[model samples]
Target: MEKTNVEKLYEWLNEAVMTINMHEDAPYLDNLAMAINVLFYHDTQNLNNDIVKKKLQTALENIQLEQYDKMEKSKAVQLAILTGMKQSTQQQHMMTPETVSLLTGYLASKLMAGHEKIRIFDPVSGTGSLLCTVIDQLQNPVEAYASEVDPTLIQLANGSANLLEKEIEFFHQDSLRPLLLDPVDLVVADLPVGYYPDDVTAAAYHLKSDEGHSYSHHLLIEQSINYVKEAGYLIFVIPNFLFDSDQADKLRGYLLEHAHIIGLLQLPETAFKSKNNAKSILILQKKSEKSKEPKQPLLVNLPSFKNARAMEDIMNQINTWFTGFKQN
Candidate 1:
């Protein structure tokens, strides 16, 4: 297939990003990439090396235009910017495309049954890809909310949302801290995984031990679960250790009591080669006041896929599982 003009623009932008000498200027690069995407979406023919360089040199104006279609070009722009940031700054703030698609497909299948409107949130929103993917996949009217600690990433997320003409309530704060908002219909995130020093908030959640060391991802899971309305869903991309590690036993017990584990998809080891972590997708429904003890969660181990064809097969199997779950 011949590459479109927008695709060529992305290639040019990516190459330009490599020539940047200062790491601190990566945020400026992010902003420039976003501007180029918006402009290209408006008029792909006008985009070229000279025009893009001119736009980046000048102050970018707000774009008021129709929403871009959900095509490769639209997705590639944000991805190219995110890739540039990662390469220059060595930051991890974006989810892989496969992870985004799997989560979005799961939500789309589950929500297809019946729902007029929904509220979705991502506590560790990163660049807002998870929330944006959900918005792109679902047919239901959705109010999206997200929080990220990085101000630059927040700007990029908000810019990407604007390019898509989607309204999102974004917070520039830590996700571990208490939020002053109503519980939402669903919470989805690819949580950051690591050890964190015990804080007052961790103490409040009872996740802090006398030893004063707590796993950050565990705390994020607990906090994200709190944001979910009763009977609502909490879906996360988490380390596979959450299922059986001795360190996570207490947290698992707490979840077994407070929420109904709906499903777990164990991803391939190569799923996040960038981070070198074995991860999985966990789906849970907040226990309703009158709901009975939770049933055993469905679990599926995905096959490793080295190419696009294999990935499509994996997605097909996932859709089958989702359909079965919805039926039962």
Candidate 2:
């Protein structure tokens, strides 16, 4: 069978990355980043293998990366990144699944309409998957910004954006720390779940625990809200236990004061390995006179992505809610 362009791109890149991996002592993810750069610039100055160089040049000639659309380019690189993740221990850097990112993108597209130009942010942009995916979904020109603390993940993310030719400004600092970014129109993140160890830094957040370490996810939500303009929306993939934890009251209090609940979609259990790790998509709008709570929130228990008929039904219902949302 003839290979699709995406498959071809992934296969060629994987071969080049493997060649680099054979010689480099660095991590596989880093090698994949270098391979992406080499593909981006068509520069093999660092790669001394004559045979692999010819093969890469041939792949570039046969496959026009420019001809591929943004989403296709993202998928190709995503395939490469998944290969790297399997060879490494950086499980925390996992990209949001394509299905979930598409779901978020659909919500963002509806939320961001009518704005000709807008700023968007992702506080924890893992490999730029969800951020870039959402950006591809928007019709307006976007000034995209993302931050990540991990060196490998950031490097891989930069390569992913570069290959897709989508310009995204990135910060390599810890997101919980003060960011220089101004308030943006929207914020999106696949919120990392765990306790933040920085007692001093966590102290500054309103969601900070009075006693022990603060939940990193809670602190992230607060920080992301701080960086969004008044009335702007925030979309988070939060764990199911987010509100059931011991610190739930304080977090709930912070939300009531700072934002309005927009929607919550409980994702299918099939998305996670265990029931305990299941997550839901939560939407919020920053508190402002202009952004009042919707009379009816869009609460849903999303069916498995594989269930086409049921998935379509949920989307139709969501569309109906969005129609009402606009009028509200």
Candidate 3:
């Protein structure tokens, strides 16, 4: 397929920013690129090089992207911007495209099987890639929402959603803190993993602490589970050790008591090439008060493949598993 003009323009804008030699000015440059993308998507008539440069400067000065006119495009410009952000030296967090695609496909299938409109959320929605992809892939309509801590990423996320003309509510705050929003149908995220030093919040939840270090990933799981509606799902990409680690016993016990494990797939180590740890996909359904005790969850051991062929096989297996689950 031929690349759209918006995509071509984004390439030029990214290359232009790369030549600027201003590391401290990278955020401004990123904002400039995003604003230019928004402008181009809305008004393609005035997209000459000179005009774009001037408008980008104006946008940077104002620190805003123009509102998008409603027009659906082939590829999301914000995703291109996200790629550029990942390439920049300052980008500290990112999930591989393979992981995102697999999760999106699985979620799309599950949501399509049901008839009701659903609400989906991501607590640590960096760049909004995961949320956007899931929304784009859904066969049925959905209300999408996400929260992020970094203002810059939130700007990029909102800008990308605008360029795609997708309606999504974005929250600029830490997702770890307790939320007062209504419960959602699905919670999906590639959760951040590390030893969180905030003991106060950990103690508040009575989270298990080991060697004076409480894992942030565990905390997120416990917190995210609370946001799901009865019989709703929580899908997360997390390190494999959470399944059997002594430190995670409390979290594991909590999950077993309150939710039904839909499935767990041990992904290829290469699936998260950007990080040094092995990862797994965990799918859990929040149990209804009247529901009976759930059966044991399906556990799949996926073959390790770094390329497209392997990813396809993994996705196929996942789809088949979902199909079987839906049938029963």
Candidate 4:
């Protein structure tokens, strides 16, 4: 098969970034941000060598950024960042898988279909994968906000959003902390799973543990709920063990007080290397006077992405359920 436009674009970016990385030895992901900045600004940054500067200038002259659409641009960004992430020894930066991002985006588009315009936020927007995917998938105008704690990932997110011509406001801080943000109509995130080391911040959350570190995912959920409008929908890619752990009761209690579960569709087992690592798409609506529980939540065991026929059947059923649920 011929290489896609996205692959060609990614190759172009990778070569350009590698040229810079070989000199500066800056982290590879950081080089990607620099490459994008140079491409947009038509100049090099912090590079003293004449040879490298000339190469970057020549590549900038030959580039046609507008030729690629959002899908191509976003995929290229993911590919470049993914390559760098694998080489890094510093942190385990888990990206939301492309299949999972596509599915979650589709769910979000449907969830907010009736609204002509809305605000959306992602508490943990690593590399802008899930949030960007959702923004691209939606049909209406959106006000997008995202926050990230990691400096490298935040740089990559800003660069990618700029390359895609998306107007996003990002806060470079820990999302679990108080954000200077207003409530949003929707929230979509690939929740960070693990213990939150910030005991001071954890102490403020209702989901905080009695002993030791608190579950970061639970605190993020609470934070997201706090920032969503009443009856607003949220879609999260959460670990399968989210509701079955020893702290499960605590999480359940928090949800009951603040939100209503609309659905939980377990992602296909084959999506992950281990079944234990498999995740689910959890759809929630923050509680309010107008919000009512669906007759029965859209519980589903999703088929593998490769099984198109089965996946289509399941989606149709979900669509029908949503139609009725919205009417109720």
Q: Pick the candidate with the highest TM-score.
A: 4
Would you give me the overall lDDT of model 3? 0.66
Off by over 4 Å in 3: 1-7, 15-24, 28-92, 208-213, 244-246, 290-296, 304-320
Q: Where is model 4 more than 4 Å wrong at Cα?
A: 1-4, 45-49, 90-92
Candidate 2 residue-wise lDDT, 200-276, digit = tens? 99999998988999999999999999999999999999999889999999999999999999999999989877898
Error of 3 at 80 (Å): 4.5
Across residues 125-221, which tens digit of lDDT does each residue of candidate 1 receive?
8767677877777778888899988776776677667666778999898888888768998888887877666466678775555465677888888
Backbone steric clashes in candidate 1, count: 0
In TM-score terms, candidate 2 sits at 0.94
Of models 3 and 4, which has the larger lDDT?
A: 4
lDDT of 3 by residue, 179-273 (tens): 75789988888888777777777775645485687887888887787888888888887777776776767887788787887777777666565
Q: List all candidate RMSDs to the true structure.
A: 5.2, 2.0, 5.5, 1.6
Q: Estimate TM-scores for all models.
A: 0.79, 0.94, 0.77, 0.95
> How should the candidates be ordered by TM-score, best one leading?
4, 2, 1, 3
lDDT of 4 by residue, 204-283 (tens): 98999999999999999999999999999999999999999989999999899889999999999899879988999999
Pairs of colliding residues, candidate 4: none
What overall lDDT, based on C-alpha atoms, would model 2 receive against the true structure? 0.89
Model 3 weakest 10-residue run by lDDT: 63-72
Task: Give the range where candidate 4 is weakest over 10 consecutive residues by summed lDDT.
Answer: 39-48
